[model samples]
Every structure is written in C-alpha cells, then in structure tokens.
Target: MNESAPQADMAEQLAASSFNTASRAIVIGGSMAGLLAAKVLSGHYEEVVIIERDEFQERPANRPGVPQDHHPHRLQDLGKGILEALFPGWREDLLAQGAYEREGKEMHLISPLAALQFPYEKDEGCSRPLLEWVIRRRVAAEPRIQVLQGHVAVSLLTKKAGSKLAVSGVEVRKQRSGGSRDLEAALVVDASGRYTRLPEWLEELGFGKPVAEILHTRLAYSTRYYRIPDSLKDRYSTVLIEGDPSLAEGSGVFSPIEGGVAETTIYGAGGHYPPVDPERYERAAAKLIHPMLAEIIAQLEPVGNPRGFRVSECRLNQYGEMPEWPSGLLAIGDSVCNFDPIYGQGISVAAAEAMEMGKALRKAAKENGPIREHELQRRFGRIILPAWWTIVVADLRWPGVTYEGSLSGRGIRFCQEYLDIVRRQALQGGDMELFGLLMGVQGLDAPPSSLFGEEAVRMVVSRSKQDAWLEKQLEAGETLGDFLERSFPVFHPASHSEANR
Candidate 1:
C-alpha cells in the first residue's frame, strides 16, 4: 500500500459534502485546537467563524496568547498524520517555510539506565509559532472558514430549550475597543484553552460547574535558543534526557528548529525549578544525567536570553459528568483538558478530537439528526483519558507531586513500577516492539490497556521475581497478582484469563 493513500482517503472524507448540518458554527479561540476545530466544522457548516484574541501576521511569529512558544514543541507522529490528512502537503509547506525534517535515526532518548536510538520515520522540526502559522494558513485558505482576530468570546448567549439552556451564540468583545456584540450561530465550540471560563459560564447559566481533576507537579523549565554549529549539524537532531524522579532533576531536551537554530529546554519537576539566569541555566544543564545538551549548548552561539515557563498543574474539566449539558454547544482542546507540555500530547490529542468531531458531524448530517452534546463530550473524554493518565502516572514519579482524582496513590505507584520494569526491559533487552508499544500508548495512538497484554503481563511477572524493585515489593508481602488486583481490579490476571477463555 502507498504511504500517501491514507492521507488521500482522509482528505477526500473531509471535503465538504452536499448535506449541511448547520448554517454557521462558531469556534472560540484561534490556536491550534480552535483552528483544527474550524477546519472540521467547515465540512458540515455553511460558515465557520474562529474568534481569536491575538491578531495574525503574514509571517510566523510568537504572540502573547501562547506564552510558551519560545520553548521546544513537538508534533507527535499520530498528530502529524492527522494534520497531513486535514491539510494535504502541510509537511512540505512547513519545510518550505523553514522547518527542519528530522528523521527517526536522528532521535535519541536518554534514560536513567541507558540511551536508546529510535529508528522512526521523518518528522518536521519547528517552533510552536511556525506550526500554528502553517495550520492557520491552511485554515485561512478554506473558503468556508473566517478567522475573527482581536476578538474574545466574553460569554455564551443561550436560550431556553425545554428544561435546559441551549447555546444560541456567543457574546464577543473587541480587545482594543472593549465593545461587545452577539454573533448568532447554530453551534458554538469552546477551544479557549487552559484558562477557559466555560466552567464559570456554565455555573452562571445554572448548569452548575463540572468537576475539575488536577495533578500538581509544579514543573518549571527555562529555554534558550542557539545557532546550531556547522560541525554538529549532522549529529542527532533531537536528544531527550529523561529526569530522575527520585532526585526530581536532570530532564532536558535539545531540538533543532527552523532558521538554523536549536532550542534547548531544561526542566525540573516537583519543587526544583530551572533558573532563567544564563549562568545558572548552564549549571542546570550541566547537572543533567547526560552531558550532550550542556556540551552542545557550550559550543553553539546564543541567539536569545533564557526564558522560563511554569506549569503548576495539569487540569481536566469533567464537563461530561454534568447533570445536564446545553445544546448547540461543545468544548474541545485545552477547554476539555490540558496536560504538561513535556509529554507533547496537547496538539496531537486536539487534532484527534477534531478528527473525531468531523466524523460525528458527518454522521449527524447524513442522518439529519440533532447533535448529542453530552454524548459527544463523553466521547472526547474517552479520547483524552489515556493521555491524561500517561501524564498523571509519569508526573507522580517525581517527588512532591500530588494527584487529586479517581486513582489512589498506591495505584499510581503500581503503574509507575510496572512501567519502570517495562521501560528497562525494552531498553536493555532491545525489544523494539515493546518499546514501540509503550511509546504508542504514550503518543495516544494506542490504548493504555495494550500495556497489559499477555506478553507484557508475562514479562512483568517473570521479571518481577528477579528485579530488585519488584523483589522489595514481594518481600513486603505483596505478590504480583495482589498488586494487579489492588491497582487494577478490572484488569486482574483472573479477569484476563476469563476474557481469554
């Protein structure tokens, strides 16, 4: 099969159909998620309007809205596939606009135990601004989509539909003029991002607030851009040094971006924040588990001063759990859930959500049925669950991290320990398939349960008796079966056997 075949098929499916679900759809926010949502909405609506607080420029540049644009950002392979389908030739467009093509052979992952070279396919390397710019250009070219810049959505305009309030439109305000106006629409999607006011708006509209699940890791990172030396250009394009959870230190990335420059971000979880001072930043980089990043930093010429960003918590607003949801309204992207940037799951998850939304809209248009807001929200929740859990489990490894949600501390520890063994096995045993499975689940391309497959369980059980960490747990009177039963009741070995039978 041709590699481009899937993209062609997806592009054909995304093309506007003769049947229309609504006259107009309004998307709140004009970032990556909002833009993708608008692109999806364009297929099923006559007109799609994106309301953004930041004004767009012809060239790619950082804006105030995306404060973390200065740092390194990655578009996961799954997300790249989705975007290629959404806008054909987007990867080439990015390269034409100065993005770098990083092949899998150029990617390196340095763990506490070992350094692994992943021979994956080629992926684009660019800053967040350029990625957003390329996608914005694609959305701008779409005839049915209109981006309303310098405008912010103030609140939802709703009307009574039986017992529940149905969103009719949004009250938007001009950021410069401070003037407000109402724009009517058949559908309103909130992609207003991590600091969304949808929960407050819902409460004001009498629907009550959704439960907010938060995992606090207090992660902080400082980034500095450097011109890549000519001698090192042929070296590894990306190097990710994993942090030691016990020490809450030694995490950093060296990524080559566009404009012949590379961005290095040194980060720490728990309370150990990377400093913004140039001297201290170097010190932090030197202290990392690997010296590659620091050595490269010393060799490259600095392009800019160090900039810092902090993420105190990862939040998920459980809008699906609401007793009643307003019709003609939906939320996507960071409005639904936002993860720590280190995982690089945000853009990919948002793209997946938009793709799913497109599929649902197509189905609703074909059936001439009303869109089920609550059901759709629940489906989006399912899409976000694995990514959220990945971040939660990973973050819990660091000292001083705390999670307030469904999973208990013991369960989190079990997951961390299990994954630790799996990771060690994958790296030390040279099990590429197992490594890929672990990465696929983290990348949101595979379900989390894939990690609990028969092969994985066998490895875990067999390795546990010999592994020092697992031996400690076993000596503490907890068997592997007991750990599985306590940590994952629904996925106990007995249940696994029963299901297989």
Candidate 2:
C-alpha cells in the first residue's frame, strides 16, 4: 500500500522538529551524486533510499549507466577537500585501493614555450568506478541508508492538495524480474545525470519545463590506457599537452595510474579530434605540445583499443528563475548543469553542488517545518550559475565552439585582452597566486566576480607582455628541441653531434 500524505497538523508538527524524523528521502539514480545525496538525506530523514536502474555491484566495478567511467578522470584538489569534509578519511580509503595523487606533484605542464614538471602534491586520481565505489561504500554502510538496485524509477508519484503539488514517492520497474512497485517517500531527489527524463516527467505533470541554455561544442574525448615503465613510474604523474588554436586541432593528457599503468586521453571540439587508430593517435598527440608524450605512447604497450565519447551539448537548466516549482523535489549535479569535460570541472562542480544541497537541506530542516521542493532547487541553482558562466565564458574562446550569450563592444575587447593576459601568465608560470585565485573560482570555491579584480588585471597584463616577448623569441629562433639543446644544459645537456666531444 502506498503511503498517504501526512496530515496538515502532522506535517506542521514534523516541521517543528530539529530534523524530518517522520519523513523519508528517495534518491533517483545511484551514481556519485545519488550516493552523496543519500549521505545528506540520511542525516535529516528517518530513512534514505537510493533507487538504481543497474544491477548491484557487490565489488568495486563499472556500471552500465556511466559510460565515461572507462575514460580518464581527475579529481581536483578542491573536490578532494570537499569530499574529505563531507566524508572524512575518504582520500585515505581511495589511496589504499591503489588510487594515485597527481596534483602539484608528478605533473608535467607543457605550454607552447616550456615544460613544467612539478612534484606531486595531494590530489585524487582513479578510475571513475573506483572513486564512485569509495563513495558508494561509505553511503551504503550508513545504517539509515538503503540501496535499492535494479530498480528503475518510472515516474514520480505526486499528491495535489489545493494549490500544492508535492511528490509523495516513485513508481519503479524491476530490471531482471520485470516486476513493478511503488515506493513512497516524503521527498525525492533527481541526480539522474545528463540523460535525465525528469523534464519530460515534469511536462507530463502539466508543469512547463525549465528554460535550457545550451552551448553545443560537439566535444569528444578519446581515451586509451598503457603500461608505463618502472623507471618513469615516479617520473611524472600527469603530462598535459595543451592544444593550440592556430592548429585548430586538440590536446592530450597522460595520467599515471596504479600498478605501473597510465591513461592518456585526447580531447577535441568539433570534428577535429584525435583518431582512434593507434598510430594516428600518437601523431596527433605529438603535434599538440609535448613530443615526449608521443614518445612515451610509442614506447608503451596499449592495454586496449581507444574508447570514444561525444559530448555535443552542455546545458544549464535555469531552475532558479522558475516562478513555481513542485514541493518535495530537487535536481542536483549533471541533471542541473553539464560542463565541458576538457576543463575537468564536472566532478568538482558536482561535488560543490552536493555540498550546497546538504547545507541548504540542513538550514531548511532547522528553520522551516517542511521545506518546499522548489526552494531547495532554486538555491542550488543560484549557487551553480556563476560557476557555469565562468566555465562557459572562458571555454567559448576556442575556435568552432559556440556560445548563446552576447558580449558587446567593450565586453568583447576586455575578454580578448583578458585571455591574452591569461595565456601569457600560463606560459611564464610565476603567477601561482593568481592561478590559485582563478582556480579557486573555477573550482567553485569563490564567486566568479572574484576573478575580475583590478589587481588580477594588472598582474596578468605585466606578465603577459613578458611572456609574449619570450614567445616571439622562441618562435623566431627554433623549435623547443633546438632551443633547449642550444641554451639549457639540463634538458639537452649533451647533443647528438656534441656527445662525441
């Protein structure tokens, strides 16, 4: 029997409590966002159930829903800290399972002019499945949380009382046995990722879908894994070969994983992407920035054929501006907004969203009796918009990438000059303080406006001029190989011809 709605008086009493002791939270989809949502809901609700469409994985492994799990994934330092704050010792658990920490250390950053090899610091690098598994384990272990695997949520069950449209539960379909059932809850969270059908469901309920702002970049990621040498095992954690706009091609990054294995992924926007063919992949990667990456690829034995993913669209649902939202429902993570994966901001932003959602839920539980579903969704949307703009605006600079918004006269000039300064700073490498600031905003730690300060502008301008001059000299003189051989003793200390001397 389906659970009936709490009476008005009973709901009022439940609202006065410190937490929603009499209510339940039903989380749709059981990926990272779903699991994190479960954790947050578990603290406030009497029961938290996660409904997953895929079969249960008793061990740490991949699921059918997350196809990008096979590709390379990097968890930014911001995400690591956020995850730790949410679930303490989470990093330690991942590291124990052979996850690599590649930030600040073992990272080879190559610009058009120089190659920066920094020692590893603290960060998280693992397969998406492994990372998800760690979080899932923690969430699943919670006594108040339940994982209902092989249960596909077909539709949200709602109860209309006068003007209030509140979700009471969900109707689910069993994958294997073809059984159907209805699970009732006080609230529902949609963390069902980019391919979510929530909008259609809302439309079916006579609610106009939220306006979507789509920046269709036709972006694609091609990934392949290889066995690294023991000597190079400790050499560099990640090698980033940035793309040049002049070439109109792409960039490649090779991240070292556990057990002497490394994953290299090439990303291209539009149809100008790296080939899946092994030889062609090497050639295209060599042209990007670092020839050494291609050399490494040539030397290593490939683990398997390269897997490809096309992200043709990035959409931001403007739910914050909605006039009316249903009660007892919210959308978090990729279901709300999807960013370009090349920037590597997806996981970081998703984690930030989860943190925001948790804070909002806690605050609402304390003050309000029964939190209206729209309020939580709006707050979460408000927090994510600035970060979305930051990513979309910056990424729109690449040729062939599309943008829906407008930037008038001064705005256009300012943006052009701004990127020029950023490029220069990125190459010269002295603006760690500024980079830290920009990265913080990029990672959603700070507001987007924080980057537009006068001090930042000045620093970028002065550094950009210096970098530009250096670039001119390098371009006029020789390739990175010849220049390094002639000037730097460390990189090309002994040349081929001079070695005999």
Candidate 3:
C-alpha cells in the first residue's frame, strides 16, 4: 500500500467537495473553549465544525463533560469585554436569561487581615451552564459553524509536509452509535480540555511528547445552592472570603446565579477539602476567616445537597517548547494550560485565547499563508504565563501543594510575601488604586507585572523587613523594582501611573 494514499485520497475528496479544504477548520470539544474557538474561527474559515463528546440540550443545564458546571463560576471583566466583542449584546443575552449584573460596590472581599471593596466596571452573576449555553447559542447562530454534539475526536489524521507532519483532519467517533468517520479540514484545534489526548496523538505521529508542568494543589470544592431570602435579596450580590493558608482554611464564594438562586462554594487547598454533608458544610463555612459567609448561608433556603469536586493537580502542556510541531495543528484552553478552578480563571482565559486566535488567523489571511502553529503556540504560552504564575504563587502557600516546573520555589515564596504586604497596605491604608490593581491582576485583566510598579514596590519594600528572603532581595545590588522585573519577566512591567489608571 502506498504510504501517501490516505492523504492523497483525503485531498481529492476535499477538492471535490463544495467548500474549499483550505477554508475549513475543526474544533474538538463543545465547552466554553471549543465554542469560543469556533466563534473566532468562523470569521476566518468558511466551515467550522465542533466535535463534542457530550450531547447538549437547547436550554442551560449541567452536562457530564463539565463536571464543575454546577459550581459557581465567574467571568472576569477582561473575558466579558472579549465575549461582547465576539458576540454583540452578550451581557444583554445573559441578563435576559435571569443573570444579574454586579457592580464593583456590590461585591465584597473579606480576608482575615482586612476587608476590601474594589471597583470593577461590571460583572454578571450566573451559573457555568448558563454562561456556556449563551456562548454556544451565539456560535450556533453563525452559519459558518456547525456543532456536532455526541461526537468524540478519537485521533488526528496527519500527512507528511516536508520534515513536519501536517494535521489534515480529525478522526471522530459517534458517542451514541459505534460509528466513526474522518472529517478533513485545513486546521485542527484541540480544545478538548485538561484531559486532552493531544500529547498522546502527537507522540503517535512520531512527535515527541510535550513537557507537562504539574502543580499538585489537592484542592476541593463543595458547593450548595439556595434560594435567596426576600430580606437578603437586597444585600450584596457577591461575597468572597479569602482562605487562610496558615490555618489551612479554604476560600468561600457566595454569588447569585440564574433562577433567583445563589450558589455558595467553599474550597480549600492541600487536602483541606470542604465537606459535602449539610451540617458539616455549614460547620466548615462557620470556620471561615469572616462570619459574613456563614451568616448568609444560614439565612438562605437550601435548594440542593452539597456537591463536591476535587482537583488533584493543574497541568500545563509545554507544546511550544517542542523543537518541532505539526504545521496545521494547534491546542487552546485547558488543552494548553488548565488552571485551578478555585481561581475562576478557566472561562476568562479561554475567551482571551480565542481572541488571540482570531487575531492570528486574520494576520495569516492578510499574509496569504498558512498559520504558523508553532509561533501561535508560543504566543499562547505568553498569555498563560501570568495566570499560571499567579495561581502557582497562591497554591504554593498551601502545606502539601508542590510544583514541578521551571518556576523556582524561592521566586514563588518571594511573590507570595510581596503580595501579602501589598494586600495589607491596600486594605489597611484604604488605597483603592492599589486594591484595584491587585484585583485587575488576579482577574486576568492586567499583567501580573502590573503589581510591581514603583508605588507598589515602595509599599511592599517598606514592610519587607519581616521576611528574611524579601529583605535579602531588597538589599541586593539591583533596585527592588529591577530585581522583580528580572526575576519574573513574564509580562512587561507596568508603570506606576499606567497601573493606577
């Protein structure tokens, strides 16, 4: 048998089809990442196909593919902006579906040290199912995109292109019936998420497996829904109580979702898992740093039993580090870098990546050449770096949490200490500028380096004497600001004035 016969046949079939193969793209998975990817690809491709393993309903509801859908999820301001650009009136659509808008003042952040209220332009309080369903609906309306639910992408079909393997299409299998078929495309995106088999698929094609960076957080979440009491309905819409690592207590979030119900999720790291039992869960909530979360939980009417989800580790597949990558293949969202759910960074990060993908596609179209998959992967690495580092620094503070990656423990510890001082100063001094910057960084709206401005450095350095490591770093030959700029050079450092704005 001819080795190139399969590739030749696929090419012939694509040429004979109505649409051009060069203008077709396939996205694996139908979740947030996949749906967003399809939306972006629709602008560049004539036909965009989404292969999803789980069947989706016309209405919003939890699905098996997204186990954490029942838990509370947040869309950061940055993500909201991108979604609005992709799907006009996105927030309005969410509002029409019972989601309420939450202003900065309506949200509260309480920690053991202090309580701070930061300013945010706007955010929506909604369930993960509602968010995904809204975006999926927008994507479904795009004539160029076709979502094929209950279909699993089993493997990638590749053909040799020069010295590299070019992904020609995807081999998909029907989830319900034991049937399979090949869907040829000019590009293949692996947005199948954290459990993605892209690494295995690449290895099968003789490409060495990408290095995996793991952070074993051992985080657990127990969430229970409640009906907002009439009296409490006028209270704050969202409250987040920061977990104390010293006491091994997890964070708690109380936010209103659709259907006039509020979901409270209590999460802890390093095996400090929240309980699923009603009584035990309330007890755990009572032990939070602040009593506000517990007080609210007591007044709300319990809607459902407490449900739990556990994350053993967060993984980032370093595909860009590979010496050579397939020409026509790319990965996005969890398939690239999966974040800790506790941070609520997954959906926002996916939306941001989709926007970047769109820009890359537009550039490729202007140049009239194939998209540089390797360079695009490197760009995504840059995008994921700050978010990855932010979570790494926080998770490392937990007792049993450990990381295996290029980041050093010393650097992580230094960042943690620096952030602690900043938080204290922001809250105690009532520095809304500093607090807003902190929130912006955490929300993935601003670069992590935004927290290292001159003003922030001065504030942190003044209190650095307590920590020996920070003292040593401050006393080094280079300026404290310069040291941070060199130490964690993920994003360009923001100026104090720029950060304040």
User: Best-fitting candidate, measured by TM-score?
Assistant: 3
lDDT of each: 0.79, 0.69, 0.80
Q: Per-residue lDDT for 1-501 in model 1, tens only?
A: 011223223222222334343488989998999999998898888878788888777789999989888888877666877888899999899899888778655688898878977654868789999999988888888888766777788989988788767998888777877767767778999999999999999999988999989999898879999998768776757889986887776489998889999889998788778889998889889999888889888888998789999988889999888898999999999999998898898888888788778767877888989888888887777777767877888888788888888865776776777787788778887777778888786776665566864456656647544456556654377676666566652432211111111
Candidate 1, residue 426: lDDT: 80
- What is the C-alpha lDDT profile of model 3 across 300-379, one tens digit per residue? 88998999999999998999899889888989999999898878777777777787777788888899877899988877
| Per-residue lDDT of candidate 2, residues 137-221 (tens digit) | 7886788876666667889889985777877778777666565666677888898899998888888887878888777777788
- TM-score, candidate 2, is 0.83
Error of 1 at 295 (Å): 1.0
Runs in model 2 lying further than 4 Å from the true structure:
1-22, 101-104, 405-413, 462-501
Candidate 1 Cα misplacement greater than 4 A, ranges: 1-22, 453-455, 463-486, 489-501
Pitting candidate 1 against candidate 2, the one with the higher lDDT is 1
What TM-scores do the predictions have? 0.89, 0.83, 0.91
Sorted by TM-score (best first), the order is 3, 1, 2
Clashing residue pairs for model 1: none
